[model samples]
Target chain A: MSVAQISRNEAQAPVEQREALPLRIVRRLANSRELTLFVLVVALALAMTIVYPHNFPTGPNMRAVLLNLAPVGILVCGMMLLMIAGTFDLSVGSTLALSGVWAGVVSGWWGWPAEAALLIGVVVGAVAGLINGLIVTRIGINALIATLGTLTIYRSLTYVTAGTGVTPISDSFAEYGRAADPVLRIQSPFWAMLVLVLIGGWLIARTRFFRQFYFVGGNPRAAQLSGIRVDRLILIGFVIMGALAGIAGVLGAARLNSAVVNAGVGIELKVITATVLGGASLKGGEGTVLGGILGVLFIALIENAMIINAVGVFWQGLVVGLVLLFAVSLDRFKTAGRA
Target chain B: MGSMLKSTLIALGMTALASAVTAPARAQESSFGPADAKETYYWISNKANLPLFVQYDYVGMKKIAEELGVKATGGRQVAVVGGWDPSLTESVKKCIEQGVPTVVDDGDLPASGRLAYIGTNWTQVGVAQAKKMMEKVPNGGKLAMMSIINAGNMREAVAGFKAYIEANGGGKYNIVSNEDDGGDAQKAAQVTAAILAANPDIAGIAGFDSESGAGIVTALREAGKNPGDIKVTAMEQTPDFFKTAKEGWVDGIVVQNRELFIYYAVKILHDYNHNGLKSAGLAAADGGRPVPDTLDTGVLLVTKDNVDKVTAALGVK
Candidate 1:
């Protein structure tokens, strides 16, 4: 099945028809949550183009939109997987801080190469994720409580580690994050996020390994009865969440050119909001990486539009909250109509 | 329990209790004010997680307090602080409850029954930044402001900035946008980047807080724009401000000296307690009028020409 229909497809597939490319693409689009988002995005983009012909449509502003969305896009991949598996990672923002700060310490203070610092950051993220997995899987703790504990621990660690003001990263490393494509004016992180999305989408579609995630989340007892290693899969899902947060942290610190202690504050809330708005349910087994990435794009567009229109900065939060509410309500209305 | 162990436990408990008391150490009643000058003084700011600058201000208060053989009190270590976290109203209530000689800083709560306020006038800080911006764009330019709009000081600053532009900017200095960064460097960079993209003609930025320069500089650097491309005036300084300012990303800095702030806050309270408001020169003796409730500790405008000398003199670098 295509990624867009991951846990939502109700009909059993016919071997012959499923093999047809045109049929599969059409079938997915007909039911895809992402299609609605794509339409909404394009519509909004066009509206913004008309309203802000001089400002919004320019290369620099468009680039800012993409750059702003890049970190969120990278996060959507792992978060989507975890959401589909009936789990949440509240500590992702704190994990991002912990990873980024540690990597910064090694690279900047300890005088290690930037590459080593980057690796350490990603590794720290993986370890942090693995710990959350162990607590939830082995200790039978609630994912919420387990991750909440890690959240406090990690954010406090960020303060302890990054507490001594801004820890400057290597100049070259920061410059690399800012490097852009000449023609498009889009930065490297945006391109990197696109690749992650493609890979994430492919993982959900082509592999039975990924397909089992739907089974595990959609019906854990059934998945276990079918001999799926449900615990191991959940563990891997959490690991992916952590590692991705790590990648985002490295990019975040590099982009800002310093390890900022307050950098990741409230980000997990934003990521979770974006994930749910993208059509994921907290109950589990109902989201797409594609939808989540688009959710990132949609939010960035709103922020840009609000600023260009000279709306009060305080209204940005209210608008975002309303969008989230609207998106959830639409999902609920759809489900109720189906019933 | 063994007798020796019991005694050791008691000793440790007593030590912990003593240190806890010392953290918010109440001073002995000595001769109060500058002349007789030995007493405990309390400086209460609104919040507990004191920013670095505020800490420096408190340190300066301590320096003077020591010079006069007195004690300076209240900081993050003080079990209770009046920042907006729990509401300054609650902190003020606590001050009244504990009978702490509280001197409110920056933010005023006469309703909280504060004895006095020692801090800069935020509106003037805003005016100073606007003046700097105006000096740069003598012919006018599209200007954006990065501020924390809801912050009490920021509200004053924004009001001052708007007032100045209206009165003197001659329609040249246009306040096209106001972006509240919520003190997030990353968000600041993103907003700055967006403002630049949208307003290609944007010529200057007035940054109203500590992190604004850091965020603006990062955004400008990534956009491949030089500091010369835009005139930037900001409040406070960050670690990288030294290089960023010298390189020209920051045009002028409005410095609110923390030392002078704490010194005056404590001294005013001390003088008031000793000789009364009139004797402390906080009240007009001739007219029986009140000294202005707010004190503008004042600001130093540091530009490229004097940033080094100023920062060096301030010992910030």
Candidate 2:
């Protein structure tokens, strides 16, 4: 791995390439999709508040929205990084099943400690991601194609191992997953997700190895000429995604107190939708962890609002699809001149 | 000598032709008998991804296989074409390749060459659910339904529901909305919530899939309505569904008799394989006899009266 040669510069860029004064303004204007999304999200929240007057902005509803965002929230973190690195991992939803069911086996059946089981689940997720990376990089498969195949394979494997039902585990396991402190006014996993987003977002924005990821995604030939190990960086992105998805699966199992079969089903679609809605480019080379998550929150808010307001759940895809199309179109418009 | 040999050959050819003409009668008898080779039976479902329901049917079939000292293992087909229709064909091909006497669930394999089909008559299930809904909401009112809308299983159930409602309620009852939840819990919750929000006057909601029950209950809870405030007739029972039923959060559920469906299939295939069922007077859909093409496993409505029996029976909660 060329990772040993890569070091974190922490606060400074390795190369001193500065944007010209007027160009900076144009650059910001061209990439104002996130800025527009941020405004839309704020406006949506306000509109929801106006409609409900009482329930929309309540603490309990906020908790629900955050909890709903937790699984996909973690996913958007990895996806943003991966997307920024110019690849994708669609197998996360299926890997979630595999990771959760396997942990249920180790912890509940094999009588391992919950912590150890959780660790093992995360490791398995990492391995699944590693395999995905290898297929895409080493075997010369496209990222989308590799992950799409694994998605079905992993989900089927979960069914083969855990069967097609919820495998209930110990009560203690559920505690870790669903525990809510009355004082905090939120669940344990909600706080954990907040911490993950904070750290993950910081790393992407600040770290040297991660900064190189943008170049790899933006242009592989340029990145290769610049001495960046594009494949390894992409592989790390997958591992991060897999690990986060694993955590989400284990948490889901714990919350249900059962190993759920289809817990993460269709989540990849949601994560991608939210990511794109949050302003990540499908062509790669751009996105932020916080921005992607805001998009997640926006979608989650809409879903919660739908249920809260009596909107048709079937319309979620239509709404998200339209929003995504709008966001991507705006992104294209912004990048047109630069490209 | 050549003329004598030619005559003999012609006589042998005549004898072969006579047998060929009468072969259908003999072929029928042996066809009813067991195969000379010892092997296993196959049961693959198109709706195999639905683990809660699929696993139970497979286990029941597996139990029968154990009793007969045969083996069986199956999986779901990836919904590639026409949603779920392809699964049936794919499973049939697997069975054909294995050369096993196969019984398929979902029963809509077109012409995939299966011994027989065994599963809930989803239309009948809808009928039963509709019947239950009418019983609950005797005073006709607005109703809602939550399902994948286009799924084959849900398609029949939805049809039956609409048929029963239209037939029974006349113009008295109205279906407010039949929203698709896409088989996701969160989506179900959101859909249920929205449906309830718009139609606060909604008298009954037919929770047509396993996901719909909890979604409906949770939305009701979130909306500050008692689970019993709305008349809910769920189509399937899972562990969570049991909790909702017990808490009076779910009014009743139409439990598909999957065990009966799977076990009956095992018995039919085993009986066919072990002996000449035809010789034992098994009518081939003829002679005004008892031979039938499909078995409706039927559904049980688990309400307050039978909630205990159902929950204890399932041992889920």
Candidate 3:
């Protein structure tokens, strides 16, 4: 481990020295898709603002968009990391449901403190992820199949936990969803998501242990020869993904003031779509925190625009489907260019 | 090996016993009311999770059954036939072919030998809801109507509402947009949210079903829009709908008595199965079995003023 760290540090020093203006620009483009998506998002926002000048550009409407993105944005960070690590976790949606139900059952039904319920949710999520990681890595099952199985099982568990009704949260717990201050008028979830994005970005870029995540994902055999514990890294990644999902779940429950058994259904698809759209390759080892956030923002902007434009609801699925196809096509073009 | 065989035999026996216990008792009663024989009524619905036609309706019918000293039970079963029209017609045909003596349906089914249709008058309900909305917004702005499916009873309901809006209200009422949510609340909510965003000036919205209604209400609340800002109406008397009404997010709901439908349907089936259609005196009109060609089980208009009355009637409080 010490030898691998020294070698990686030495590799980083040379790359830093070789960095020039053109190289920096290229690196910036490569590392963050936000520039492109930010422009697109701004254009869409402007269009909406023009169409519905009275309502669309207002502070409250902007706050609504940000608030709506909070949970998915947070979950996408973990999803991007997992995708970068060369694995997928479709169980996050189910994990979200289970975590929310667990929290609600504990706090609302069993009279547990909201804080304790949240803790339990995160721990349980991590445990579930650990099991998934072990099965995928040790038993050599495909991550997709393993996570898919867990998805069904976990969703069924949510049904069993909540029965059939929405489990209402206490008023005190619901207050967590209120705005932190008047300046933003955005809910706590949005602020928490920003903090998560920063931490995630730092972890991916600055941490020595975390740098090994890319190598392990890029090539497990090569990473193992470099003395990185690939299996353990994968396990840790899954656990982090699960914990983030749990936090998102708890936040969702708080925001809705109820833990609906169906709260997070199909969320995994959205998270993965955002991660992939952000330039994360399914083949592994390439994605950035900033890029993932931009991807989420872009998708969210589309949703906001659809709503603002009064596009019929049936067209939403069609629009999302088309966007996903475009993103995949662009990814192929980028990969071909690199090759 | 002998012990294993004995255990296997016992397990098989237990399995058979369990199935027997859970299976519907054969319909062999002297009359529609309970006799020495135990009769079971099997009712099938389009969706298992239906809170209204399946749950509330069954509960109401069960009460009537108990009053008449009969045993009643319902299960979450989908029609082998799909779609509102075919499903309704097929359900009736299946019931007749399978010798299901009496079948009560929520939608209009092909009348062969079935007992009755104890469901909402979809056309009337839609017309009534539309009339109320027209009264509120006399100039009739854009109205959005949501349905679970674009077929059968829902199609009829929307048609009825549109007819009334067009004829009586003139150019005042116009259905600007319609959406089918596949009867899923989350999908319905998403659809409603999108619709609300697109047409903020929409004067009224109506959800043709319970889940859609709840979804529309949730979407409205999420958007921070007041219920009165856009007149919203829904069908069924669910706790969520009741709360939405109380909170002033929903303007009104058309309530159907599902219980009465089920109770009478079961009774008619029992009578037919026991005495045959003719012997039961169901063949002719007035003097025969009291199977009205179209029994108006009746509907109640639920609003803020009368919500408490409806809730109390449904024992929701």
Candidate 4:
């Protein structure tokens, strides 16, 4: 009986082969873009280490790089999610400025508790995002146009709140900006970033609602046919992005001990660059939390190395732009190969 | 006419004598009546922030006008020709175009056609600041000059200081850097931090503008460096800046009286309206003013010793 069964299975092996090959190919292609980006990040890190053996490989230097990139990392996480959901939030930088200014004004100028002020800032950001979502979805405006409008409005709001200057935060709030303790010697923002990354990773990987996000971005018509709440998901994604930007704003304000009206000027470009470099397609539906963190770290390391090498400030922007172009090109090549 | 003519001649002589005496008396009594003076003058400024000329300095001149019972009216517009360079070239151009007879400038006005240039002698200001810095840092050390914006005046100030230092025989002092702070306090602070990190031995820093000074003070405090460690000097006085100075975060500041600029500018404008540039040579009592071309409105050195007094005088508690 066992021999007869084995011969029967051998006869059906070609049928199974016909079923499995295409699926395997598709799966490999799906992961190829992210895998290539990951390799590039590792290669860049290795190159940095080789160039600055004494500082790049050291624990202190690595910690500094991580700490500096924490805010950028948090922002990129949200930016990637938004991109995955097929929307752009150019107003994140302005939102960050507004949140920071409000937080500083509420707590510093008005002497409110830090916790309350932070809550209000986050809420304000969420509300702003909601308005952006409504403008994009309900009002049938393009995400880019809606966000650009909010960007100017929010920036102007920041100026008004900050009275066109820097508003200093309280000492206690500033303490939150410093490194946690000697044993860790890592800033509070670093810890917050790690937690945020973990939570974002879980949301993206484990939840069914989160899975719906990919479908919405991948094919909105198909997702709508499949009974996914596409509009709601997009709105929620924007809300999360806004909230994260708010958190970043507060962290930045705390670190600087002052909320400058121009606090997050040009930050949107950096965050978007990191997201795109992390393999989050501008076309939508592809990104990873780990990839975003690595992207930010790569940029931070380059900046740190440039500073350590005593490069002129004027050249910094050009160098960063070139690096961004290179990363985007590599991403495109990898994506093309996968397709 | 001899006998009867003798009588007639005596009468004619008497009549002629009477007519001559009356004519002389009438000439003595009939002088020309007093003429009415012109009451309006045209004044112009490069921009509202032309500082001593149009803003704070104008207040003092307005008071002088009121005291002298002169009617003055003019408009302050953004710099028409020059943005930062307050050269008389633009003012001269404006004067000629507007048919302005007399002109008073904050020294930025071109000397051409202007009745007077009544602002600080910038070169002298630079020399004075440099001299003060030298006095503060006798042994001489590295100094950084922070400009609000890298404008012409600041460049001139730096040039003046550099010339003075060079002329006096360059000693232990050198200008380590000249950073543009963009008049933003945060940026100013960041730039100062970078400068300090790059040149830790900077013994003195001078701010060419208000915000830069505040930024330098903040950076110094954060770096755990004392005011004495780096002799800091800046232009103008704000409440916060004075507080910092009181706490010894600043060595001294060069305070210019805006009143002087206003008073002189208006007076020069009046002189230009009535007497033109030539009449500006007349004494103040004689309704004549000095068209020094470059006026030293005056500067006060505010140090720890005089910080309180100056603050009190400025009413900045």
Candidate lDDT values, in order: 0.73, 0.70, 0.70, 0.66
Best-performing candidate as measured by DockQ? 1
Candidate 4 local Cα displacement, residue A229, angstroms: 1.7
The clash numbers for all candidates, in the given order, read 5, 3, 3, 10
Please provide, for model 1 over B1-317, each residue's C-alpha lDDT reduced to its tens digit, 9 standing for 90 to 100.
46456456544643463343233222222122354444656555433222344335555665767765666665321111223222576666676557555556664555665556667777888899988888888889799999766676777788898899889987777788989887677788888988887788898988887777778887887777876789998876543465666778888888777567767766665555454446344353232223345566888787888877765865644
Please state the Cα-based DockQ of model 1 relative to the true two-chain complex: 0.23
State the local distance difference test value for candidate 2: 0.70
Which residue pairs collide in model 4, if any? B1-B5, B46-B79, B57-B258, B57-B262, B86-B108, B87-B108, B88-B109, B88-B110, B102-B272, B282-B288
User: DockQ of candidate 3?
Assistant: 0.13
For A1-339, candidate 1 gives per-residue lDDT tens digits of: 877696445444554335478645544543566886787789999998998788888777877788878877888888889988888898998888777777777777677877887888888788778878877776667999999988877765565554533446777667646677888878777887888899998998678899888888899898899999999999999999999988888888777767665567778888988888777788888888888988888888988888887888888889988988878776765665456
The C-alpha RMSD of each candidate to the native structure, in angstroms, is 9.3, 15.5, 10.0, 22.0
| Consecutive 10-residue window with the lowest summed lDDT within model 4 chain A | A159-168
Error of 3 at A12 (Å): 37
- Per-candidate TM-score against the hidden true structure: 0.81, 0.75, 0.75, 0.63
| True-structure RMSD for candidate 2 | 15.5
Which window of ten consecutive residues has the lowest lDDT sum in model 2 chain B? B24-33
| Candidate 3 overall lDDT versus native | 0.70
Q: Model 4 over residues A1-339: C-alpha lDDT tens digits?
A: 699999999999988757477666644543554565556567767886777566456554555556657778889888888888887899998888778777777778779898877787777677667767766665567999989988987775664445433335777776666536566566687888999999998888788888787888798899999899888888888888889988888887776666656666667888988888776778788777777777777777666655445565557668889988876666655566567
Winner on lDDT between 3 and 4 is 3
Quote the lDDT for A268 in model 1.
85
Model 3 misplaced stretches (Cα beyond 4 Å): A1-32, A178-180, B1-125, B147-160, B179-197, B209-227, B236-240, B256-275, B278-299, B312-317
Q: Which stretches of candidate 4 lie over 4 Å from their true place?
A: A1-70, A184-186, B1-317
Candidate 2 CAPRI assessment class: incorrect
Question: Which one is best on TM-score?
Answer: 1
User: Which candidate, 1 or 4, has the higher lDDT?
Assistant: 1
